[model samples]
Target: MARWQPKLGLVQETLLLTLHARALDAKLPSPILGDTLSAELAGAIDYDFGRLKVKPSLVATTALRARKLDDVVRAFVAVHPECVVLDLGCGLDPRMFRCDPPPNVGWYDIDFPEVVKLRSEHLPSRSHLIGADLTESGLLDDIPGDRPAVIIAEGLLPFMPGDSFRRMTRELAGHFPSGELALNGYTRFAAWAMKYHPTIKALGIKAAQGFDDPREPESWGAGLELVEEQFLTRAPEVALFPQPLRALTRLTARSTGLSRQGARILRYRF
Candidate 1:
């Protein structure tokens, strides 16, 4: 059994941090995401997990975020059985396996070449792997435009850098005939705080993008409409969080302002 060692740059390396968080959650008595695939990948990767300093709260939030995104995928695929699913900045998350869409559905995972190479080394080739910077023009051209597309960004937003996020959204909205774009969003403060978040700080990650208003993207002129905003604090899954954190979440869940300071998922119709 050979362990696959990774050599990703700073931004790309954050994938492991997120991956390890889900792996940690899967080990719990009653996990939120129950992503055993991530757990197996974490064990096989020859990286120092301790250095990421992944805490229980991060694990809980990461899994919950993934669970929420998975729900979005399931719902979309149910409505549009012949739709396409795009998991951008996919890393080695095994979302295609988790979603397990019908044979008629097409799933594609996009990431940097290094990460995609690493994914091939560890996971089976289920989805089409596209290794190109999302900001590049004509990236989505290769994907079919005939079907509805469910685009998921996960933790890939802040890493988009500068105004690239704006351009990316417009491209996605125009590329798909119809569908939704879903991702874990950060408020202005939440995005700024990532600089010092324990796990993020440990990896020296600094995110530059954030929007306090979920509706702000609607103003991006991207032909996107706000479908729903799911703050993690108010999520039904928050009840599963550990001890003091769970109680604290219940307290803050009442306020969208406080909730936005934490984990929140945004979905939009195009």
Candidate 2:
């Protein structure tokens, strides 16, 4: 059998990094996300994950952040079983499967045409996959606006320019009557560090935008109100880390300023 080789652009190819991170976590005895599907999908591909040199901390952080997002989605769907879920720039991640929203929920995974094609071929999903550039107009027209919606932008925001990001948030907010928007946020300092980080540099990906304040998005006219900001370092999952890493995370968790420098999951109600 031939290994699947990914033909993706630099930005799109960065999905492999998160995939690798999840795969690594799946191997742990007490995994944070326990996404063995990521490991299976990763193994089927021919790409060389060795070159990324994905560290343990990276894997733990990725899984922890994903789990945090999953918790938010699960909680939302529990209350609004008939909601609509739009996973913007979803890439190949099987978030719908992880969240397992009720049968009444409508799940849509949106991404570039090429990536959507790849997802259709590799990942098993019940989601309605839409192939389109998120930055373009009329992309949101296909999504139903009658129900409450949950818009999740996992790794999509940083790649978007500031103006585009603002416009997207506002458009999405306006599309739904009321719902939650969850995303992994990067502070300006974290964005800078991402550029120089060995793994990120290897992928030739740089974050196009970052924010110092979680509440800044509210000013974008999205009618978005900051609900909560979850710092991964402070999450209970950190206890699953190795001894040294766990201690370091606990120490950093003590300071809001220091924890903000790492990964954060931000939730907003619109």
Candidate 3:
């Protein structure tokens, strides 16, 4: 079988970097994510994984965020066993596989048509797959609104421009009668720094959208209320980090202001 040489947008290309990061994390002796599927998918893709320059810090944070998001979804599913899930801007993460929702739950992985096509080629069909541009107004029409949704936007927000992210949130909130939104929050400074990140730079991303205050999204008329702000720097998983990286994370964890610029998972109930 021929390897998949994906043709994706500049923003979509970032998925490859995250996918490679998870793949690398899986290779570790005591992997954080242990997403072996990512490792297998990375091997099947026809791309230069070396160019990603995925660092240990990147691997740690990426896996940690995914783990945190998965935890939220699992908890949500436990309560709302019949809930629907919207994995917006899902890329090729295969998070549905990691979450493993029961048969009654509806899991929809939303992404660009090409990215969805790529995922279909590699992963099995376990849930609903909606392949389209996220900006489409009626994209969620086929998704029933009666059931609660567990929306996970893992590595999504930054790529959305200006009010697009906010707009998307509003749409989702209105689309689903009730649900929770979980994502890796980025402060304005962190979003700006993302452009200079080697992996982001190589992917040619310019600027990204972010909020200094996690509660700011509540005012977007999305009906979303801040439930929790999990700072990964202070998370117990930091113990898994190697010497200097673990030490650095501990130092940053000392200050909430500093930790906000690091890895953060924001949970909002709508």
Candidate 4:
């Protein structure tokens, strides 16, 4: 095995696939993710965004889903202007640039220290970057406790074990008096499939925790209540999906059972 150290920036890690989606959006008639920054970041990093080889269909799917997730976070913050928004395990995503919350909103982008060090080297200085491990770092203490909170966990849960996921949730709920959490829910099949997914397998990434039911988080603690469920297949965003696949995604989204098997974005409030 090659013993090369994995050198990657925070945005670089996320751009692995999302950058391809951004390029697709630029060529499409209608783009789901209107993130110009992602493209620019990919350029700044001199990354071969095109070679990601995310099929056009899958690229569109990811873009559309990302757009929807962006909307969810924006809406939650809008309602709670005093909210502290934390992007857990935030790789190299320029969400802060995309969302651009008001001056009073406290936004945090948390990730491994190595990733943050790379981020500091390439990305502009942002007040939100917290370099620490989500699993064990006592970083959340740095966040002010006086405000309401909103947590964004996109593409994060699958990387963590069930116990770690549960424990983190418990701590987060305890830290913030009241808040909302939005995350992409993975199914057991999705978790198993991740072990074989080409790019993921290449990175030696494995999925650890997945739930068959959207409401499964309720089992973890009484502090959370299921508020909304978003199945990508049914969302109007599917209209942006690449030609033939749009119909298929729409059909799958309409089926409650099938939707559960596919990627899901769920919300909970505490």
Q: Which stretches of candidate 4 lie over 4 Å from their true place?
A: 1-6, 9-15, 47-52
Q: What TM-score quantifies how close candidate 3 is to the native fold?
A: 0.98
State the lDDT of candidate 4 residue by residue for 171-270, as single tens digits.
8888888988888888988878867766565555555568787777888974889998888888777777776888888778768888877767889998
lDDT measured at residue 237 in model 2 versus the true structure, 0 to 100: 81
**Model 2, residue 241: C-alpha shift (Å):** 1.1
Tens digits of per-residue lDDT, candidate 3, 151-217, equal 9998888888778888888998998889999999999999999989988888888999788898998
- lDDT agreement of model 3 with the native: 0.90
**Candidate 1 on 41-80: residue-level lDDT in tens?**
8998899999988888899999999999999999999999
lDDT of 2 by residue, 12-61 (tens): 88789999999999988999999988888898999989888788899999
lDDT values of the candidates?
Answer: 0.90, 0.88, 0.90, 0.74
Q: Give the clash count for each candidate.
A: 0, 0, 0, 3
Better of 2 and 4 by TM-score: 2
Stretches off by above 4 angstroms in model 3 are: none
Q: Can you rank all candidates by lDDT, best first? A: 3, 1, 2, 4
Model 1: residues with Cα > 4 Å off, grouped in runs = none
What's the residue-level lDDT of 121 in candidate 4? 63
